[model samples]
Target: MKLHFLGTCAGTEPMLDRKHASVAVECDKKLYWFDAGEGCSYTGHNMGLDLLDVKNIIISHTHMDHIGGLGNLLWNIRKLTQMRSELPHFDGVDVFIPNEDSKDGLLKLLSHTEENFCCDYENRFYGVQDGVLLDDGKVKVTAYHNTHLVRWETDKPLSYSYRIEAEGKSVVYSGDVGLYTDLDPVIGDGCDALLIETGHFGIDIAYDYIKDKNVKRVFFTHNGREIINDREGSLAKVARLFEGRGTICEDTLTVEL
Candidate 1:
């Protein structure tokens, strides 16, 4: 499986050479999108990725940085299908979002675009809840609620972290968390790779939290001020702390596992 980093910046003021948070896991020629941050689709396409191959899009939360590019991503897919005169890889795409209201709002806004935002393929939306979100034989994805956002309603969780298991490897995507411990439930035994966010915490905090865990690799995304201001210094520090097991991810970086 290949992990693609589309956007790696945090939800802070805009920065050069980065957007927000977005990643794609490619397995068996199919793409599983984690978050649709700004310029996600554009970056993926420009990186030579096939947007039509995206079968599922899972959002950890409805934060602007996480879902900023959602509408544009969908539009780009539809535009590609039209231009190529070919159907999408799947009959429909499954979009798992924690907030249905946000999804509705995005769809409503898209309805005003060209062709009424209509396409040949269906873009099905699903409300994300705890437990297994997808099991497509090739990959299994499970969701665990996090406290990044408070839940005013009792029906479902408002924020989440994901555990993706594919080809005997388990990976965790910590969207944004109120605390590092918020991921204990999903971390479970351990994960092969942890794609964590550093937007809310510092690198020292992250390292201290996962040092005892069984995670094999750590890729830091959603960078905060510390890493943004002094990337080289932060990377040097991470290299010393993690002994090469950690990475300060940048946009368009692809890693195979």
Candidate 2:
């Protein structure tokens, strides 16, 4: 399996070498996108990734920084299919979103685009709820609601974190949380890798949270001013604190696991 980092910056003013938060996990030649941050599709395509192979797109929340490129992503997929004269690997694509209003708004916007944004392939949207979101025999994904966003209603959750298990390896994605404890449900006993966000928290806080959690590796994304302003210093701190188990991810970085 391969992990591709398309965007790593937090929801802040534009940065030099980063966008928002986005990543893709490729297993068995199929792509599963984690977030559709700005320029994610463009970055992935330029990095030689096959966008047509994307079978599922899972959004952590409806925040603009997280779903900014969603419409453009779908548009690019259709454009590429027409340009290549080839059908997508899958007959349809599945989009898991936490908010129905965001999905409806995006679809409404696409309705006025070129060709009415119509295509031969189907693009279906599903509301993300806690529990197992996907299980294809090869990869299993479980969603856990987080406190990043508040929901007055008890039934619907507004944000989530994910646990991905595949090929005997477990990976956890901490999609923006109000507190580190918000991921206890998904982290369970432990995981091989944890893709954590440092936008609302500090690196030390994250390190302390998972110090004895049995995590093998930690990849930091959705960075904030602390890391962005002093990258070298932050990296040095991570090296000393994590002892080679943590990394500050950059755009277009691909890791084989």
Candidate 3:
């Protein structure tokens, strides 16, 4: 399986090297997008990724930084399909979003476009709840709720972390978690990779929290002060704590496991 990092910056003002928080997992010629941060699709496609092969889009939450480019992504998909004069090879796209309001907003935003704005291809949207999202033949996706927001306590507990198991390896994506322990259920005993978000927390804090955990590789995303302001120090801290087990991700970086 291949993991592609499209954007690695947090929701800060524009940075030179990074965009936002987006990643893709490619397996068996299919692309599964995780988080649609600003300019994600553009970066992904320009990096030689076949965006037309996208089958599933898994969103962690509705934060602007996370879904800022969602509408543009859908528009691009449709634009490419029209350009080719063929329906999407998959014929359908399944997107799992945590908030229905955000999804509805995206739908409305797309509806106002040109050409009567009807998508020739099929796009199915699913409101994600806390549980197993999918177990495709090649990959397994499970969602665990966290405490990022407190708007609607009655409906959803709020944010989420994800555990993706594929090709004999497992990866945990910390999607703007409220706390590190919020992933206890999903992280469980161990994972091969941990695509953690450093937006709300520091590198040392994250390293200390997962030091003894069973993760083999730690890739930092959605960066914050530690990474942007004092990168050398953060890299030193990770090197000392993880001893090469940790990696600071950048836009367009790809890794295979």
Candidate 4:
């Protein structure tokens, strides 16, 4: 499996060498996109990835940094369909989102685009709930809710983490988690790779959490200022502390496992 890191910045102001939070998992010759952060489509296409091969669009939550470029992504997909002689492999895409208002708002936004967002393929959006989300032939994804935003007990959750299993390998994506323990349910005993977000936490916190856990590789995404301000020091620290198991991922870099 391959993981393409399109954007690695958090929900902070503009920064150099970073965009936002987004990544794509390539498995079974298909692409599964997670988060449509700003400029994701631009970066992905430039990286030589066929956007048409994307079969699933999974959003952790509706935060701006996470969904800012969603409309543009759809528009690009439609635009590319006209340029290419053939259509997307899936003929359409399934979008798994958590907030109904956000989904509705995006659809409404798309309607204002050219041709009223018309296309030859179908695009479906579904609300995300805690459970086995998708089990395509090559991958199984499970969602675990987290308390990122304060809400009433009756309100549906607004945040989640994901566990993706493919070809006997497991990956835990920490989607702007409220706390590290928020991923316990999805992570279980261990995961082959932990794509943990550090937008709301630090590397030390991650180190403490995974030091004893069975995480083979750790890639830090949605990074905070500490790492950005001291990348050289952070790299050395991670090398020594994680024993070369941790990496500060960068946008446009694809890692295969």
Error of 2 at 27 (Å): 0.4
List per-prediction Cα lDDT, in the order shown. 0.93, 0.91, 0.87, 0.88
What lDDT does candidate 1 reach at residue 198? 97
Worst 10 residues of 3 by lDDT: 149-158
lDDT of 2 by residue, 134-205 (tens): 998998999999999867776467999999999889999988998999988788989988999999999999
* TM-score for all models, in order of appearance: 0.97, 0.97, 0.96, 0.97
What overall lDDT, based on C-alpha atoms, would model 2 receive against the true structure? 0.91
Candidate 2: 10-residue stretch with minimal lDDT? 84-93
> Candidate 1 at residue 100, lDDT?
85
Evaluate model 4: give its TM-score.
0.97
Q: RMSD, each candidate, Å?
A: 1.3, 1.3, 1.4, 1.3
Report the lDDT tens digits of candidate 3 across residue range 166-216: 888899998888888887788899999999999999887897789878889
Cα error, candidate 4, residue 30 (Å): 0.8
Clashes of 1: 0
